[model samples]
Target chain A: MITMTRETLFNLAMMAALILFPLWAWLADEPFMITLATKAVILALAGVGLNIALGLGGLVSLGHAAFFGIGGYAMGILASHAQNYTPLIETPFLIEGTKSMPVIWLVAVICSGLAALAIGALSLRTSGVYFIMITLAFGQMLFFFTISWPAYGGEDGLSIYVRNGFPGLNTLDPIQFYGICFALLALVLFFAARLARSPFGLALNAARQTAERVETVGISPYKLRLTAFVVSGMITGLAGALFADLNRFISPTMFSWQTSGEIMIFVIIGGVARLFGPVVGAVIFIALEHLLGGLSDYWHIYLGVLLLLIVLFARGGVIGTLTGREVAHD
Target chain B: MTDPMMTDPVLETRGISKTFGALQASKDISLTLMPGEIHALIGPNGAGKSTLIKQIAGGLRPDAGQVFLQGREVTGLDTPARARLGLGRTFQISALAMEDTVLQNAVLGALGASGRPFRFWRAALGDKDLRARAQDALERVGLQEHAATRTAELSHGQRRQLEVAVALTLRPKAFVMDEPMAGLGTGGSLRLTGFLDGLRAEAPILLVEHDMDAVFALADRISVLVYGEVIATGTVEEIRANPDVRSAYLGDEA
Candidate 1:
């Protein structure tokens, strides 16, 4: 018999709300609501990606925006080339750009994964505050590089003429786009949940808790962390592509430190290592921004206060508060 | 006498020397852990017993020496690489994953022993082979009943037992245990001493310990370290009788 813990029950409810609320918005003909929900979903997906490295793996990367931005650029460069009817690289056996969502996602995943491999290899060598600073530095370097490159519109950013095409749906339809983003989020969430229970995940989690113990158990913490970081970056990069598609624009701000901080905030506010933590965090964060933005221009003061409360009192975040501290065995 | 030329030591450290600035932490420390023998390394505090163990366990690089496992030189390998090569170890302080359950901690050791821990699809707890290995180790340590209990919740003695259980999962060629009896009470030390007596038959142990009674009770051979050098290495009787060991370590107790 499968016993559902409160955390499990809460996770189910969160997933249900994510789907049902978006569905209700579509039914009520509130396209704007659907768009907002889609934004939350994409942001949550990025947080899920970060959660693997930061939460489970205990890598406090302040440079994930590098992967996010790369993913955005992957979509932007590909879509723009498709619009202009130009090949991406004529010398490399004529590689033409495609406006296909699947293709863009693949490019985004690969680019971000490679970047993660490079960054994680170097950055994972140092831990604690040094790790955070190195990641932040790498992100800043990417931000500066993108601004100076000028070919991809530099600081002005690249605007996709049309949203990338999915095989079966109208990409322009708000509900259809929301469905795609929601489906991806659910799929990735499922993957993340499975990963947390897998052998690799167990080893990675062990590494986070006691690295020396992990080492003595014949697993290199470095290898485990690097692999997790790469996987994390790939997921976030995929979200970056979807995020750019949602706005029909890509910018260097995607690589900004604020983006990395926001991704981390979602994980922290939800519950550091909890599976659905990011989803709950992103939804609540978006909700607060929307509700409080109209109330005052200094609405950040309120977010600051709430974040302080969560950090000081609810170290486990929203899920931790609701479900209690006892982690689910399964 | 078992000739050194005829049989290979399970673990051997030759000319292992390490200096921390002006102080010599380990001075030409040569020791051998023969097959199926509990070789106890006993020293007073600040005798650099830990420094020698660190070099053997691959935590610290020695200025000069060689660490051989099963007759193969593994001096250059890192801690994990040495572990993978069958050098199981337990720390002086408990190094368990406190948040994880006892079973999870054992399973992690089993996963490391499996040689293919990179698999990310199937649930680790559900893997029959890994579970069986972890269960068998826990059962050996008599901790099978508390398999689901969080490691942090386990008693101090239980955590030590859990550490041994984790090491057992390695199926190691040798065990390098540092101060396994450090925080244990008299009863706990006695129980662990009895356990270690039987464990040496599976894999020879290089035990660094403070509890002399447990060391005397368990060690097939004892090496006494003084000021980062082994003053005497012999059977328990010889070590107890050694004048150098008496003056430097055993002291008033001897």
Candidate 2:
């Protein structure tokens, strides 16, 4: 493990700044800014989850929105059923409804893991552009299904009357919710960094560079890739639960293809393999969205132009551009 | 011959052959290696020495015949599987992890012998035992100082030395070297030959080489291959004296 020093210290200082942002909002009596910061933290957690697959495992999953949406739906449906004192989706047997955050996260993980396992088994059979297309297809399939379904708001979305229960924290406090997101993001980052350095991680990288060589070393590339994919999905699913709580709403829009594309954009615009890249990317993206949205209604077009410039010239993204250092996998 | 020869033939190929569509790359190749023996596989450029070695190394599946290590059949296994069975091989074109440090590349080979490479959270850099083993392998190849250097930064000869160190990490019972001396300068070749001489006691070595001088100096036995067939197999002196080997592979003077 690398010791925290110099640039890492600077980066941590930036995080400290972010953690104290709500205090600024409190002093200025800007409740809106506090809410926005909380939202950014939750979304950043989602980007952190996606980074496990994109940054470390080199899996371009354009279908992560499915996991995120599944997580949000799990929370929303449970809350709705708890309020009604009935099962969320009963079709002759299964009964499931709890407004517990931990339970929601567990359910989200299981559902997303199973989905990723099934999709990865098929998708991993192909490489390069084919893999990207297949994941995209799966995401679109879920998106269209969510939009067409009638039970939980269809395309309109579902609203929660009350925030979900936790063990001790006040569910209404914005700073407390932000703390939960911050803790989860930190945990996920720790896991991702550990996994990227593990033997499985080495094999994952070997599989990326030379599949034949890894096979010679007695590992099947498919199994390694699928395992990483499942873990990546489970983490992303947890983020989805937090996202639902942040909005106090869940909708088909959460599972849309655009959402998947945006998450991928954040990872690429940071650094694909760097540990802190996605966090920096999320910060920049949220800031740009806020600043640019205030500037004009044609913000997306200008964003498109900026993205084109970045893609064409700056391949390594912000961290890479600043550090001039590539992601060193040993 | 000897019990070591009869007991654990470090590498054994029985009637192995491979055909790619209309081309028969290898034909009914049968060979064996005893402990401490150096066997040279000599052939013309298109004679399929590489194809035969590839089958034995588990890189290619033979269309016919079996490969065995210590009398156990392993023809169907993958390259890594064969490697774990104490079989090591180097490539003709240097198939190394060029992006990694030389020490890390060696660690990859030694990782198989060290057990349990699946622990992702544990730091490998701080493990004194693994570091010692990696250092030993690098020292054997005269690359201890170059351990921290990236393989991409090494000269071609140095990279070839690193390849040997990588193989040494497995502590292999047999080594299948595909042109280990290719493109080395005279000094580099002498260093490699010296390294091989020290390795002779450690394991049986199957050397595929175009370097005739190295072949004559190192081989305990010689096998001449012509158009995917073993035309001659004997002592270096005997192979030199044979008319068919001379006509087909060595030419008039070689």
**TM-score (chain B) for model 2?**
0.96
Question: Which 10-residue window of candidate 1 chain B scores lowest in summed lDDT?
Answer: B1-10
Q: What are the models' TM-scores?
A: 0.98, 0.92
Best by lDDT: 1
Q: Report the backbone clash tally of model 1.
A: 0
Which residue ranges in model 2 land beyond 4 Å of their true spot?
A1-7, A88-94, A328-330, B1-6
Task: Give the C-alpha miss distance for residue A27 in model 1, angstroms.
Answer: 1.4
Docking class of 1: high
Residue A70: error of model 1 in Å? 0.7
- Chain A vs. true chain A, TM-score per model, equals 0.99, 0.93
Report the error of model 2 at residue B79, Å. Answer: 2.1
The DockQ score of candidate 1 comes to 0.91
Off by more than 4 A, model 1:
B1-6
Query: How does candidate 2 fare on TM-score?
Result: 0.92
